[model samples]
Target: MPKKTRRSVDGSRLMQEDEAMTTGGAPGSPGGLEEIFGSLDSLREEIEQMRRPTGTQDSPARTCQDLKLCHPELPDGQCQPQGTQKY
Candidate 1:
């Protein structure tokens, strides 16, 4: 069996790491972690809004009706009642 040589583990540090170490908010700086948390909270709110049901009118049955209206040649079984239609 050939002896396997381990490669050097040390790699060049990224520029972003150096910047992150140097540049930071002063004591008076308004926006930093608080701003990030606020943005995250807003994002969570938006995600919750998206996760919630919009309305019953825009449901799968309505979608099936729209699809059926667009393509009448498609079998009724492909839409609803007799068969399952997924959004």
Candidate 2:
């Protein structure tokens, strides 16, 4: 069970301001979609950077063998090399 609550005018005003900031647009202004797209592009770039591997010891690049060395801790047998059997 839940009780219904009404939003106050002040809360509504704050939400409008937050929306403006999120869209990078003022009330009754154009180019809001462009601004939002630009923000999204920036966010995409940030996410790409975070996905890249850092050149530190903890984030050092390793080969498939190295990955297999740590395979016991891997989920779904990831990094485990497949065997080549002769017929």
Candidate 3:
């Protein structure tokens, strides 16, 4: 059998399509870097919010109270062992 030939590809057109997909618009247009950076900033802010601790108190005494509720057999002021606690 004769060797098959490969079809030519338009490299520039492929690049343009890729850029449009990545930037959500034509390359170098207003919807490109600015939009991407804005989205990234919002995402960063969301992540920072998640990292921050909420104002709600989570003291060890509260945890002991909760554990006491879960395991009434345990005496007051006693919490279950770390490995033995129920999930």
Scored by TM-score, the top model is 3
Candidate 2: where are CA atoms >4 Å away?
A: 1-27, 54-87
Tens digits of per-residue lDDT, candidate 2, 1-87, equal 455467434578778877876776766675677877899999987665445433224543244444434443543333223332111
Can you write out model 3's per-residue Cα lDDT over 1-87, one digit (the tens) per residue?
A: 556456666589888878776766655574676677789999997665444422124323234445455456754432344423322
Query: lDDT scores for all predictions?
Result: 0.51, 0.53, 0.54
Q: List the candidate 1 regions with Cα displacement exceeding 4 Å.
A: 1-30, 54-87
| lDDT leader | 3
Please provide the root mean square deviation of candidate 3 (C-alpha atoms, Å). 11.8
Clashes within 3 Å, all models in order: 0, 0, 0
Candidate 3 has its poorest 10 consecutive residues by lDDT at 53-62
List the candidate 3 regions with Cα displacement exceeding 4 Å. Answer: 1-7, 15-30, 54-87
| Cα lDDT, model 1, residue 85 | 62
Candidate 1 residue-wise lDDT, 1-87, digit = tens: 556456633345445444554455323453455677789999998665444433233433335555555456655554335465633
How far is each candidate from the true structure, as Cα RMSD in Å?
A: 14.2, 12.6, 11.8
TM-score of each model, in listed order: 0.30, 0.32, 0.34
